[model samples]
Structures are given as C-alpha cells and as structure tokens.
Target: MTTMTPCQSLTIRVYYEDTDFSGLVYHASYLRFMERARTEMLRSLGLDQRALLEGAAGAPIFFVVRAMDVDFRRPATMDDLLTVETEVLAVGGASLSLEQRVSREAEPLVSAKVRIVCVEAGRARRFPPEVRAKFERLLPDQA
Candidate 1:
C-alpha cells in the first residue's frame, strides 16, 4: 500500500455571509471551510464521521481539535472561488496532525496546521484498530 496521502480539496464560493463589512472573507469563515475539508478528507478515507460520532453499542467516538496554528497570508474577496486543500502530516496513538491551505487558484490565502485527538467518554483515547489502520495508510514513511 502507498504511504503518501493525497491532498483533499473542497471548493467554496465566498458569499456575502462569509464576508465582513470590508467585503473580504472573514477569518472565521476560513476556519469553517477548513473544517469541512478535513471532514471530507476523513470521509474520502472511508471513515464515516457521522456514524462514528453516533457510535455503536453506545460507545461514542469523536475527534476534537487539540490545537491549530493559522497564517492569514492574503485576502479573498466576496464571490471568490476558493479551495481548501488538506493532507495528513502525522499520526499518533490518539492524535493526528494535518496541514490545510486555502487558495484562489494559484494564490494562497491561508494556511494552517491542526492537531486532532480522538476521544471517547470525554477523554482522549487511542483510536480503534480499524481507524488506526486506515489512517496509517495515509502516513508518510518514517524512514
């Protein structure tokens, strides 16, 4: 199996609601777009978050963002077509690191590194074996 993970991209059309009074996209709006892209990234890997969040046998599983570092490099104005690209950077026993970027074609608007941790019963927990195996496939070779 290939160790490199392909970047996942989600297109977003900047709307009036996503913009501030200055007509530029709001900073929080980028967060929303990035969140959706990351969710889609997991979905593309065959991990259904809705089902996982609902859980089976009353075992609720969820992923929570542990930290995030964002860089707002450029601005995206209203009606801009933006794409959020996401890639897995690393994986741990209970945490995953990801890099995400927002761009308008060739112009980068924002970049972020996020750390997410798996949780069960409101505490950090090791990912399930199935989930671990799936994410492992996306991890780059340690060597």
Candidate 2:
C-alpha cells in the first residue's frame, strides 16, 4: 500500500491542439497531461518504459485504466501554463490508485483519482518483484 505525499510538478503550456470549441481545453486532454507527467516522473526515477519493455526481462508492462473519478473545477483556457501534480494513493497487488490534478497558476482546474491495473503477457497480473523494487525506492516511509 502507499500513502499520499507532495507531488513533483510538471508544467505544460496549453496549446491550440489541446483546446476545443470556445477556446477551452477538451475534458479528455487533462488525462493526457497527467499521463505525461507520470511518465516523466518515472523517467526521473530511471524507469524508462521503453527500456523496461525491451530489457533483459523481456516483459512488457502496460497500464489499463480501471476506474476514474473526476471533478471539473474550472475551465482551462488556451495558452494557460498548467501544472500536473501526481501522488500515489495506494498500491494494490495488481494496481495502483493515483491522485492527479490539472492546475493553472497554482489553482486547480481539474482533479481526479485514477486506478490503473498493470498488464503483462497481455493479461492483468500483479506487479512483479523487479518492478516493485524499483518503485519502492520512490515511495515514502510507510511504503
């Protein structure tokens, strides 16, 4: 299991492609932002997905969204510099709970709790020991 902690911030500028009609970002785009933030966070921790999939283990790991709860607090306008903040909420045997947020000027525009199940061998499986060992290094005291 995991517990909440301060998140590492990833700031991205909103562009036209991220927006829809009325000059606001499309709701689904927030998910992409959060995904990128998480990916970069892992990279900073040296867990490169590409290498992980093609390494000596030769096992591919992908995440499948299992559950999501979102709240649209405010609309994100074009050209806004937004930040995605992610925190690990809990780690199950085969999945993890994450809290992701999209913010502008430090104010939250959207927030979500996302649950993703790990996939290996084209099927859902508990995270392997190697993966767990790598992730544990990034966790807080209670992890």
Candidate 3:
C-alpha cells in the first residue's frame, strides 16, 4: 500500500448553514465536506470533474464510492475552522482506498475510509497510465 498526500487541500469554516437544529454539524454534512476535499484533491492532479463531466476534457469519469466506513467521534459547532484531510491509502487497478478526517486543533472530529472505483460510462475501469503515473509521483518516497 502507498499513501498520497492530498495533491491539494481546501480548508473551510464551519458555518451555520452547515449545521442542524442543534447547531451541530449534521451527520450527512461530513459526506459533503469529504466530497469537496476529494474533488479538490483530484483537481490538483489536473483532473477537473466539471470539465470531464461536461465532456470538455473527454468522456466523463468518476470515482464512485464502493464502500465507506465512517466514525463520528465528536461534534463540530458552528464558527469552527475545520480541516479536512484526505490521503490516498492504496492504489489498485480499478480502485483506490482513501482515508479522510475532519479535525479541529489537531483533534479528530470524524474519520472515514472509503473505497472508490474509477469509472467511465458507469463501468469500472483502470485509471489511465498517465493518471496512475501522476498519482505515483504524488506519493511519499519509500523507506
């Protein structure tokens, strides 16, 4: 297995709109947060989801989540600066394992592991050679 530092990361503030009736971020909100981070991470690798989906960059490609296990350890209140961290934990022929966490002051509020399959036309397919090569280049050096 290999780990890839998010090619990019976008930090965001927890706003009132992100919370529920109790002012605590709703359970499903974390999924949106992770999605944003993951999208940006792919953008950093030069894969623009919008362009791809619009056919400007080619056939629409997506990494559909095949499975995910998330743990909600704590609640994040409004006005908090939450950092969403994403890392590529493993790369496979047609799928990758990603690890993500939402943190405040180095404390984990949530952590999740997601398995995503690379797809085109709704069928799982291997990533392009160039994309896989680029992803390898994003990995930290071996020990």
Candidate 4:
C-alpha cells in the first residue's frame, strides 16, 4: 500500500439543497465536494487546470475521471460543517490515483478512491512534465 502525504482539505457547509427528503445529504453531493477538493489540491500545487485545458501551459490537456470507487460511511445533515480531504496515492505517466475522504469533525462520512486520466485531443496522453513533477513531489520516499 502506498502512503499518502499530508492531505489538502476543504471545508464545506451543507445546504438544504444538498439534502434529500430525509434531510440527509444526497449521495451525489459528496461527489461535488470531492471534486472541489481535488481541484483545490491541484491549485495548491500551483497547477491551474484551466490553463492546461486552454493550452496555455502546453498542448491542451484535460483531466477526466477514468474510474472511482466510493464508500458511503456515515450520513451528514444540512448545516453540518464537513471537511473534504484529498491526497495523492499514485502518479502515473498519464493518470493519477487519489484518495478522498469527507469528514464531520474527524468522523468519516465518505471515502473514495479515484483514478483520473490526462487526455489531449480526446485521447489519453502523458501529463505535462511540470505537472508530473509537481505530483511526484507528493509521493512518499521510495526508500
């Protein structure tokens, strides 16, 4: 198993709209939270996804979700303050594996394993060298 570095966390306040009839957060809402955390993680690493998509950094590239496995552990209610934490698990030539968890004050609510692939011109492509280098820095020491 790969050990993750310190995670990037984003706090979110649950709104009424994020809940279903039971007042529990809708399952899909967790996806949005995790997505934001991942984006913010990249931003914190000095990677602007929009620039990459617009080809400002290099050839146009987009990160797309290739696969995901999510486990819904606990339920959250409206107005609850939740923290979404994202960490890099693995960085590949053209893909990244991440682990994200949503928690309410240290109690885990949701956990996910996500795989994202870099695509250029609608096909899989290697990550830009700079982007890969930044992600590589997050990996644990091989020793």
Candidate 5:
C-alpha cells in the first residue's frame, strides 16, 4: 500500500512590508513564508521550537537550516494570498529534508528544497525516538 505523507499548508497575505517598491514580493519574503510553514508543521506534530531550545524540562535541541535550494517561478503582489505547502522529503539520523512550495490560487510561485540538521550543544545529534517517530509518520513512500 502506498502511504500518503503528511503535508501542511499555511496561508499568508502579502503585505507592503514583504514587497519591494514595485509592490511585488521580494524574493526573501518567500523564504520567510516557507520558514513559518515549517515551524507550524513541527507544531502540528507537537514540537515547540522555543521550548525545545530553551531546555524546558528536556534536553536542549535545536533545528537549524543546513541548506536550501529555492527557485522563484513568479512574483506575488501586495495583498495576494499565498499558500505555503510543506512536506517531509526525507529523514536521517541527524538531519531532515523538506520540500516547500508557495502558490497563489493553485499556481506555483516558488519552490524550495530545505535541509535541516538537529543539533544539541553545538553538535549534530540523532533525533530522539519521540521526535523521529513524528517525522517517520510523515515520511513519503519510496517509489
């Protein structure tokens, strides 16, 4: 059976602050949207970044972006409602890869492949079982 991976979507409205003088969203704005979507995805799985990093009764764990490959296919203007879709592409002992896309009414505007690494005390660390389980549940089926 082919399992459907968990995907999360967040809607963001383009504001003047997110755009350039031309009223088009700056390229960096898409990156911010994608980052928010990823954070929300983790929250949906019961992970709180602030608490995790603050060591609130648990070992301090931090998620850091290791690499990003982004493509800007189109520009969004102020007031445009953009949807950021995030999906888990892969998970490793100490890293996770995600695919995120920004779309406007079903039309893709930007796409990115992001790699994140798990760190504790400035060193890479394997994901704890609880955290790994959450990600595993969202793992895409291998073709």
Candidate 6:
C-alpha cells in the first residue's frame, strides 16, 4: 500500500444549492469540493494551473481525471462545515494518484482515490519536469 503525504485541507460550507430536495448534499457536490481541494493543493505548491494550461509554463497542458474510486460513508446536510483533505499518494511520469477525504469535524463523510493525467494537444503527455518535481515534493520521504 502506498503511504499518503501530509494532507492539504480546504474547508467548505455546504450550501442549499449543493443539496437535494431532502436537504442532503447532492452526491455530485462532494466531487466539486474535492476538485477545489486539489486545485488549492497545486496552488499552494506555487503551480499555477492557468499558466500551465495557457502554455506560459513551457507547453500547454491540462490535468484531467482519469479514474476515481469513491465511497460515500455518510451524508452531509446544508450549512454543514466540511473539510476536504487532499493528499498526494503517488506521482508518475504523466499521472498522479491522490487520496481525498471529506469530513465533518472528525467524522469522515466520504473518501476517494483519484487518478489524474496530464494532457497536451488532446493526448496524454508526461508532466513537465518542473511540474513533476513540485508534486514529488509532496510524496512521502523514502528513508
């Protein structure tokens, strides 16, 4: 099993718009929260996704979700303060494996393993060396 790096947490408040008629957060809302957390994680590392996508960082590249395994452990209601925690599980030549968890205080509400790939010119491409190095810094230290 791969050990995950320390998490980058983003706090999100569940809004009415994020909920279904029953007042429970819509299933898809969790995906949006996790996506924001991942974006913030990259931003915290000084990687500007917009710049990368615009080719200002060498070549235009877009990070796209390749796969995801998600588990809904509990339900979240509108106005609930949730934390979306994202951690880098593994970095590869052209892809990244991430673990994200949504929790209300200390209780986990959802969890997912997401795989994302770098694409350029509509084809999968290796991550730029600098970009890969930035993500590598978040990997667990090999002792």
Clashes of each: 0, 0, 0, 0, 0, 0
TM-score of 2: 0.85
- TM-score, ranked from best to worst: 6, 4, 5, 1, 3, 2
Deviation from native of the Cα of residue 102 in model 5, angstroms: 0.2
Off by over 4 Å in 4: 1-5
- Point out where model 3 deviates above 4 Å: 1-8, 54-59
Error of 2 at 51 (Å): 2.1
What lDDT does candidate 1 reach at residue 61? 90
**What shift in Å separates residue 32 of candidate 6 from its native position after superposition?**
0.4
Give the alpha carbon lDDT tens digit for every residue of 1-143 in model 6: 23334678899999999999999999999999999999988888788888999996688998999999999999999999999998888999999999999999889999999999999999999999989988888876621
The candidate with the higher TM-score, 4 or 6, is 6
**Root-mean-square deviation of candidate 6:** 4.0
Question: Which prediction has more favorable TM-score, 1 or 3?
Answer: 1
Candidate 1 residue pairs in clash (backbone atoms < 3 Å)? none
RMSD of each: 3.0, 3.8, 3.9, 3.9, 3.6, 4.0
Candidate 5's residue-wise lDDT over 1-143, tens digit each?
Answer: 22334777899999999999888999988988998998888888788889889874268999999999999999999999999988898999999999999999999999999999999999999988888888888876632
lDDT (Cα, tens digit) per residue for candidate 1, span 27-126:
9999999999988878777888878889841467989999999999999998899999887888899999999999998699999999999999899998
lDDT of each: 0.86, 0.78, 0.79, 0.89, 0.88, 0.91
* Whole-structure CA lDDT of model 2: 0.78
Which ten-residue region of model 6 has the weakest summed lDDT? Answer: 1-10
* Number of the top-ranking candidate, with lDDT as the measure: 6
Predicted structure 6: lDDT? 0.91
Per-candidate TM-score against the hidden true structure: 0.90, 0.85, 0.86, 0.92, 0.91, 0.94
Count residue pairs with overlapping backbones in model 4: 0
Q: What pairs collide in candidate 5?
A: none
